[model samples]
Target: MSTHVDDADRLARVTLSRTIEPGDLRVTGLVSELGAGKVLGYLEAAGEVENHWGFALAQELGRVDPAQVLVQAAEQGIRFIVPGDPEWPTQLGALSNTGALHDRGGEPVGLWVRGAHDLHQFAGNAVAVVGSRAATSYGTEQASELSRDLATMGHTVISGLAYGVDQAAHRGALLAGGPTIAVLPGGVDRPYPAAHAQLLDAIAERGLVVSEAPPGVGPTRTRFLARNRIVAGLAEGTVVVEGAVRSGAINTAHWTTNLHRPLMGVPGPVSSAASAGVNQLIRLGQASMVTTAQDVITDVMTHAARAATGAEQLDESFVPDPVRYPQSAGPGPAAGISASRR
Candidate 1:
């Protein structure tokens, strides 16, 4: 398949992403049907979007300048990748088939990528390792070991680049001399936890850093939820090393299960609150128990590639309970932004 998208469409996507947050299914549906340029035109000419936040962002079009955005990104060694771009990961196509979880679902309109690796190659056959931002030592160690072994065995690791387990997983992949992918909730130009800037730089040198948010944007709760889906979508399977009952990793696990990918949980001490969510998942039959890297590899390999085409395996009526993202607020940039332009 050719990966050449028109520059005009690419520029339109940049503007759209600038005005919209990632993973707005309503807008994604429109983009899937009308094309980015046409969709932007529609928003620009008039707010024809019905009962959607996109209508709210229709006025923000004047603030978006795709050409300037591209220039700024280029200066920072970042590239904007639209759907048909050569570096676009085909695995993300699976997201289009998955149902909403926390009201955020759909393929991203564009991705802001940094680092040397091509997302198309690394994402499709990867394994996601995620957990709480405030993980326990045991959790981080297990995530690290699992990622290290998976890397040594030639599996690319994908994570959300958060604190705790996410950081450990990336470090493990790097230590094993394997490429890893970090999906962020903010712009590629700015690392969310500023303290991890050096780590982010190191990953960029050896792997890839990706985000759906355009450059200059910051992270938000909804953006983090959206980023979780991409982490699940990029990989063939996912492992939750540890998660609080209401943590983002649990959110990611739901995305994995809903996507029909294999979901594995690393068992922690019975009393550890950090592992509560993981234990709950395993106990509830939402995830299989996995203790070692080999166990993870076995399960992941046995069920690999299903996430990208497992519509039959997934329950169309499935709805995740204990929603983490706030239902009262939309996953937009600001109060009225509403990820509206995509």
Candidate 2:
């Protein structure tokens, strides 16, 4: 917790490296104690760590040397955000059972963040809007509009930097001149899909691009799953724009539900495959419907007011179809919308 320790960062990195491959009990025991940089320092300090559990773990699993990773990150001018640090996101720490990791056991111990933006301002009152990679034009527009409205209303917007809905959310917030944050599945330096490099750069310059992974790491299926949790954890609520039943956005919705955060979904035409997951959430009572920024703001405010007042039942009347699109008010897209619209 002390940020000024001389050798602590190096030890943290060593701990990270030693927890891999054969996995040293000594390093593993220190996992919860040391931060990422300190762990790596411990590994290097020992000098005998090459291929001894730590090296193999980094090599096989593609985990970078915590110290080396930090150096690379610093080269990119990225800051390492550790738990209990000034810049560490407090909302994420709410998942104590998950060790303050993002999402429901998906996020890592700390994040490597690159940007001049203040994540705290966004984290305290943020909403995540996520959906399918293959988004329809209508879905994209709705996502953008939702993001714009959220930003205009002073809510921080959070999302993955993936194609379709993810990209739209970031763009919308930027276009609206609102603060937004992109949670990457890989290291902040590794922009997945490679196509959104410019978008990622814009985010880092104007907002923030964050990742829990050490630097130099690339995207993997597991990392993608992990990224979703950070998206959910950073926000007070989440809105599913468009996605299939088994889509990653659905995973985020589930995480939101588990976190007791309000989950909202923008309904698409029933015939649209992208809306299937959201519609299903609505049907299952997992998420409420949200069509406009007003709906989201009202719900969030109501929840906050109730919590402050120690009320058991928060008011849900501000939204029309509380279960379907609670306060949603938008034209439904045509059925069979393509994912590319996003």
Candidate 3:
């Protein structure tokens, strides 16, 4: 079912994935304007490069064997996804205009996906559950219960595949036989924590293992920060189970707010240091307080309806200029499509 053009495009993106730094919006937009093949050609044709994108990417371009990269990934049961593919999640396009965050921004040029769930489809109906890695028992309990309830409603729970809150969130969804997605900072073929190898496998069997990095790449601090946007971008809204004022969970909430999506936070004991950040978010009107699944649903639905009403009956096809985008993030989360199928 793959065309020669499709194969070439996929290969170009695969090579670019290794060369380009993750979340480089300038280059990503260039890839969007010019096709991947043209972009690769431009890089190859340049004998010496001055621009950061071309310079940085050109160095790696010589080292990359596109065909070999694709073959290796395929051998590992990993697929390279470029824009326009059936499984490509268009919602990521919103990142193009999200501006840069800590010098990281832009939709991925392509994704390295493992597992059977369809990326585009499942991403549509997803909700992100993120919190601290050093989660308290109460925090983990809330995360699990909240995700379980959301899953029972057929909403997919999406999270970074880290320890603490992220792990608990994924488990809760699985417990309810609900769909879940594990977004990783490293290669989907390799588990990060190593200890979570079994848990990651369980997620792959039922949901998906997604990443922006290519196979064989290990995670770094920058990659971890870049990974949060994907977690927030894929979902209609984000729920912070527990976050310190400076935790990654709060960082995700910032992305949720930046995306103009509904942001919800669960309150913990005021005296507890673990709850400081989320409490700040709630206090500052950065996020609404959500204690139950119904609360999250109400906030999500209400915001969706209000956004719809304010947009002059506009849909995904008509984004306001203030949003800095005209691209459709695709219809808000839908059912999951198997990764191995169309």
Candidate 4:
């Protein structure tokens, strides 16, 4: 299944992944224009005369030997999937349009994957469930129940594998014997929280644990933020169970909105601070209020079916325009929900 050209491309992407930070525009642009092998060749050469940033990146590239990294990854059962790979999730292409997430918005050069399940299959019919790590019991229960219900309906549950809501969601999906993908901020081989080492291992055994970083790299705040885009991009929709008004979950919601994907939020007790972000999105009409998993499945499938058939003539009352909920929009509860046709 491997060709010489495919091997070279995969190695080049692994090198690039090690050389630059995730979502770095400079490297993305260079790889887009010259291809990864050429970019590596350019880095090997010492003739870079302009762009201080490019020069610095080239200097860093010289330190990494791509072949060795590949060996290390293979020893650990990791595989690098490039754009041409069949396992590469095509939905990630939507990230190219999310300029607000990255300065040089483009598809990832490659992904460092560690799992037996195909990435494309895991992403298909997926719904990302994200929220604050500091979640309350109510939030945790809701996330778990919703994920269980979604998984029972054959939708792959996707999350960042963080604490609280994410943990609950992943566990719920696993309990239902459904595939669950954990998009990591750090390397798939290095679980960030450390406590989740067993959890991550279980996920890789049954589903997937993928990242942009190489094997030895650990997570930083910046990596965590950047990885949110991948989580949002891989899913057909994103659900925020509970979070503050300014949390990473909200950031993921923004990415989902930017990609024109269905965004859903589970309402929690108004008295709980953890529910602030979800309530805010609902009040501003940025997300559809989804109380149950059936609500999520219906909304996601309805949107997908409509898009597939070019049936853009849905009743205006059923489709809420996200544009109406600008960042500066004031607080007001969303209007009545449209009845699900199914």
lDDT of each: 0.81, 0.71, 0.81, 0.81
| Number of backbone collisions per candidate | 1, 32, 6, 0
Model 1 lDDT-worst window of ten: 324-333
Q: What is the per-residue lDDT of model 4 for residues 241-296, given as tens digits with 9 covering 90 to 100?
A: 99899999998999899888999999878898999999999999999998877677
Better of 2 and 4 by lDDT: 4
Predictions ranked by TM-score, top down? 4, 3, 1, 2
lDDT of 3 at 250: 84
Candidate 2 error regions (>4 Å) = 1-68, 98-107, 314-342
- Models 1 onward score TM values of 0.86, 0.77, 0.87, 0.87
Off by over 4 Å in 1: 48-53, 305-342
Q: Estimate the overall C-alpha local distance difference test score of candidate 2.
A: 0.71
Model 3: what TM-score? 0.87
lDDT of 1 by residue, 218-297 (tens): 99988998999999988988999989999899999999988888999988889999999999999999999987655665
Candidate 4 residue pairs in clash (backbone atoms < 3 Å): none
- Scored by lDDT, model 1 comes in at 0.81
